[model samples]
Target: MLWEVDQKVKEAADALHPSSNVDHMQNILQDTLIHCWELLLKRHSATMQIDAKFQDLLFRALDYYVVGRLHEMLWWLVCERCQVVDQLVKTRLSHLRHAHLSALQLGVPAHYYTPLPAAVVELASLASVESAIGRLQCVHSTIELIQAQAKEARVTLHQYKDQEGEPELELTKEELMALLTTVVVQAQCSHLVANIYYMTHYVFSVTEDDPLWKSLGLLRNTLENIMKLDVARLPQPAKSIRKELSLQDLMQVSAEVESRFEAKGPSRSIGDITALDLQLHQLTQQIQLSTQAHSETHLTERNSPSRRSDRTMLSPTQDNSKSHSFREFLSSIPSSLRESLRRRQSQQRSAIQSSLNG
Candidate 1:
């Protein structure tokens, strides 16, 4: 039945040219979905009464299958006609494939398996659409939810064995990246490159300072970093049963295993937002350090020791103006770095006060 649906979808996709508009593509997909749904219902009605769980699974499977096939067809059309796949798109696709193969090698334990979060699935689905605002909104909401979960230590670490103690409040960057790689592999969404290209070409009202814009950047970086991660370095399941399977073999096994399990109740959260936040902070620090070094060099070349001393010995008004400028600079820093700086400053003040009292 699925093969029949697949054939029909392929036929519909075959009719589309590389220059087809978004609506033409959407209409083909929408019509295919409606037809597939009716076909599935008829087949199930003859055998057994479809329960909610089965229905949910059916639709999800259909969505993934139809969308994936359609995307492949569209990708091939573009490649055949345009004679070029964007280099970044090719890199991402390669990364996703590599990550999937690495994950298969780990042989993650059944009990440890964490299904992709619903929001993450929705994020991928929205990326396929043409609506920039809608996609941005979904991205923002998804990142926010993932951040909340991470803060609460609720994101499951599938690669690690369960411990007797409470979960750690903070996750390291490696752990976060490993979990993200797993989620992306399991998502199996197609046309990632095309979706990203579409968004890049479309102009929207987002800015660099906005959290939404930051979230978008974080997501893109996460996807890119997938290729760089070494699955062997991540914490392994204690009882993993290693299997030597080819990529095709692993994919087949995965599909079979997935079919056996009903979708687990929202098994885990998504996004390594904390890891990305730390990355952003490190980047900001590097820029600040470079600027400071340049300033120091320029100051050393221009100012004599006596002049430097005179400049340092400021009046109350000059000190106030300097402090105001410093505050303004702090305001421009990313929130995470600003908070870290605030904590460090408070700790230093406490230490100085204690020393004076002593």
Candidate 2:
């Protein structure tokens, strides 16, 4: 099953024109994956009586494998231009980081920017990796940390509500936005847009209910809002501070970090999924275990009143125009195709639950 899917995905990828639009390539990738998935289901259903759980696990492993392989192919196909874009991303992030640190030193409250610098650093680290899966994981982890911080801030606000002498400790929505602005500005990610695009169109297939997908959407909204912010309105660092944080120092630090990452070796790369010794069954088991653990944790959180409230507080107000545009995109998709894709994803989730019990 894995071999067949790989062959089909490779053939589709190889057929793409070198100059094809990224959006067009994304569509082709999705259509190809769906085709392969449907074919696998039909071919296997007749020969063997595999449970839906195993079937879903098989699909997930296949999805991971295909996406990882495509990441490698895309490096040569589209990411050659990404090298130039990455340099620009790095430069922008450097400026933002310097500004953030300067803001801290220049009397801006440290609490206002506490967790955001860590978030930026985490994302900047992800810039070194070219894998879509790697980037997705990094974004997911960063969002989780931020979400926890936001929850803590909310708790602190409630605890100090009646206290007379308490400091202004609550992280308000405006403060959150300001801090997020800093993060969006400083996320030094190479192929950032492409990674988001790839994950949305291919991996999650725009499953809005998925937590990771929702987190990515929130980040996308934050990135879009950057243009609306008045750059001059933001606090300016002292000339001395700006001079102290030289691009040379930034480059040296980045080089040391990259060296550390490299020393850990290619085992961290998504390409490890395609290793000859890693059997499909083993991959399926790993994904199944992970899915089960995640589902259990999600259920526990959903049932917690405090967790529910925290989620409500943490959810950002999305841009209405952007929401409408997304709705329009969904409506533009042929009803039949949308139904097919939705049905497939639903099956994948349901199958995971059913298999875990068995």
- The C-alpha lDDT values of all candidates are 0.47, 0.52
Task: Residues 221-276, candidate 1: write the lDDT tens digits.
Answer: 55655534454455544334323445455445555444433243243233322332
| TM-score against native, each model | 0.34, 0.51
Candidate 2 lDDT tens digits, 188-207? 56555445554554563334
Please list all clashing residue pairs in model 1, or write none if there are none: none
Residue 322's lDDT in candidate 1: 36
Give model 2's TM-score versus the native structure: 0.51
Residue 14, model 1: Cα distance from true site in angstroms: 27
Error of 1 at 334 (Å): 20
What does the lDDT read for residue 65 in candidate 2? 62
Error of 2 at 271 (Å): 52
Candidate 2 colliding pairs: none
Clashes of 1: 0
